[model samples]
Target: MSKPGKLIQELNRMVNEQFATPEFHHFLTLPLNRDRARFFVTQSAHYIKNRRDSWGYVQGAAPLDVKAIIWKHEEDELVNDPRCNSDHYTLTVKTGESLGLKREEIDGSEPFPAGRAAFYAWLHLAKDRPWLEAFAASAILERRNNGKIVRGGSLSDRIGKKWVAELGFKWDEMPDMKIHRDADEAHSDLMEMIFNRHVKSASDEDAALRGARESLEIDRAFRGALADAMEKIS
Candidate 1:
């Protein structure tokens, strides 16, 4: 098989293993309550903002061609998508409304201490690592959220369903979650294309995988922290 194909397989394996981890499963299986839902929606907006910061760092550090790719990826995120009629943060705020959250509440909320640490960890990777590693770290989150890649369902799909079943939310009501459920597939594809185009050497592949693995570890920690916070929301 081709080098990129092999690398993709390796990446897929890493993601699959991530899903199987106890921390991941614990976070996913946590019961959703109204208070928890509000907390999650509010905190996730902060999480999304952290993503914007990390991606900006990555874009600043990337090569010209990779910067172009990152810029295109940011179009649907940072800018208003004519299709959705909103950008990602706005969409999250809209989702927050369903949880009885005001835009101000979400916008003004502080990141939990653990969430703050996780965000900094991600930012460190984006800023300090090689562009390939930084790109891989950011892309792995989307790739993990790709239902086509993850067995059973993606994170967004699973969480969306939980909100519906547990919280009586309509699928259409959570625009941000629904949008990511579909959009990350295309995002993952784009990242994979970049991997294929740029990752030609063993060292490059190792760096990419290292980034993916470390990012996934941080993701698990982030989710675990969220779960802990959710449990305390009563």
Candidate 2:
């Protein structure tokens, strides 16, 4: 098998393994109330903003063709997507509406200290690391969200199911997550395209693995911190 194919299999394994971590396990198992749900969606809007910043930095450091691909990916994120006619951040705010969150509430949401630190860690990878590593750091997050890749379901699917079971929300009322569950399937294909085209040497594979590993670690810490904060809410 080719190096990129092997690398992709390893990355997929890494993503699935995350659900078993203490952080992911705790976060996913948390029982949801309306207040906790409100807090989660509000905080998630900040995460969406961080993704925009990191992807812009990654775009600036990438090769022209890669930059073009990132730009096209950002179109659905930064501008209007025909799928929802809302940029991703706005879509997140809209998601909050289902939890009784007003626009100002989401707009004023702040990240926990650990979550803020994790966002900065991702920024460093995107802005200062090698372009492929930076690309992998961002792409791996989408790969984690891609339902086709993650067995059972992606993060959004799991959380959305919680809303239905615990908070009485129907799947259709949570369009933002449903949209991402589909969108990431396509976005993750873009990640594989980059790897197949660029990951030719052992060092290239190392860079991708490094990014994927570190990003997932930071993601664990971030999710753990959010769970801690949510626990304090009720």
Candidate 3:
């Protein structure tokens, strides 16, 4: 049974390791034409919405203090983020618009079958698991996006670079990606605080690790599925 600090290190290591997995490698390495890029952006809006839904469930299941923190986190994602002067979802739509996607196109898009399954899986974790586990499940995603933790510039940073190099868009043009690159870092720090406070025993660490592991597996499948779908587009 590892100490909580050691467990946190292990979890951060696990997230960094995900970038080396076949699913992430394949998804990130795939070529991006305008059509493929547009497809990805549209699909990403669905992913963003799923985050909102999953977080709502987590908030409901968490302790009151944790719930308050989660609510504050939601303000940036669901209500209004002062940094972008828009909610995260609206920022996603604007990002798609930069890629020539219509608002209706993004709004009407559905997650791929695997993405749908992943969303439901996360919802289950957030809604049905113990509060610590549920909170870890949702927090792990933000941890994966935290550049300080992920070491390889985080998911959005890597993907945004692809857009700049492959699609010829400047960094400033992708407001959502830019904002999340910073936002998730702060969010993950908040999550870490919770683990520091609550993950006292091996049992606590185990539950949180279970949730994080399952969430990452689902994330890998969802990214792979997105790549497979994009490959078929054109």
Candidate 4:
């Protein structure tokens, strides 16, 4: 059940390469900070917020079935998943309270310019492209986050470890990194299955490749911004 014109294999290759790039390291470095792990945690929250916005745009243009799959994925993101009892944003805020950051700080800090631009660019791509292609961009973003799929560890897991070891955070108490490390595993696998099933013809495949490439380009920049902001904040 692939698309009218899909190229899942090539897109998969491109997306796989994107996962191995240096951008993810740059993005997650903030969480490695001993003095400012909380800032990184908050910044990560912003990153996930951007992800939600991009996913929504993709959902708006995807096929009904794809939309449904993405909607289920959003259950772990926008809505509550029974496994966690909270959405991704709420999870971040919970981490904030633990770090002694005020809720106003979590909810009120506007996204940095770079993060904002990268997000809107992704949203534009998601909104304007063909459904599979658009959906591919958002999927590619998760694939980047799915450290399990990425080879080392997901950014969530690395950040989680950093919060405890490098930052001297309470090893047992960091919920944001703890929960996502497990949840994104399931999310990424589900997305991989979705891609395998839906991408059919060459044209559709090309669109998927386009989505992966464009999103990766922006993601590199997005992650770079996250790292930069973390450094400055620290």
Cand. 1 Cα-lDDT: 0.89
Please report how far candidate 3 places residue 203 from its true position, in Å.
Answer: 0.6
CA-lDDT, candidates in order = 0.89, 0.90, 0.89, 0.72
Candidate 1: tens digits of C-alpha lDDT, residues 25-133: 8888898889999898988998899899999999998888889988988988989766587798999999889878899989889999999999999999999999999
Clashes (backbone N, CA, C under 3 Å), per candidate, total 0, 0, 0, 9
Q: lDDT: which candidate is best?
A: 2
Give me the runs in candidate 4 sitting further than 4 Å from their true place: 1-16, 19-22, 27-35
Encode model 3's per-residue lDDT on 1-234: one tens digit a residue: 437678789889989999999999989999999999888888789888889888999889788989999999999998899888899998888888888888998998887788888889888998899999988889999999999888879999999999999999988778899999999999999877888778888899899999999999989999989989888987
Model 3 lDDT, residue 71, Cα: 93
In candidate 4 the C-alpha lDDT for residue 214 amounts to: 91
- How do all models score by TM-score? 0.97, 0.98, 0.97, 0.85
Deviation (Å) of 33 in candidate 2: 0.4
220: Cα error in model 3, Å:
0.5
RMSD of each: 0.9, 0.9, 1.3, 3.1
Give the lDDT of residue 173 in candidate 1. Answer: 88
Instruction: Tell me the deviation in Å of residue 218 in model 4.
Output: 1.3
Candidate 2 lDDT over residue span 1-234, tens digit each: 899999999999999998899999999999899999888897788888899999999999999999999998999998987788878887777778877788997887788788889999999989999999999999999999988989989999999899899988987778788789888888889998999999999999999999989999999999999999898997
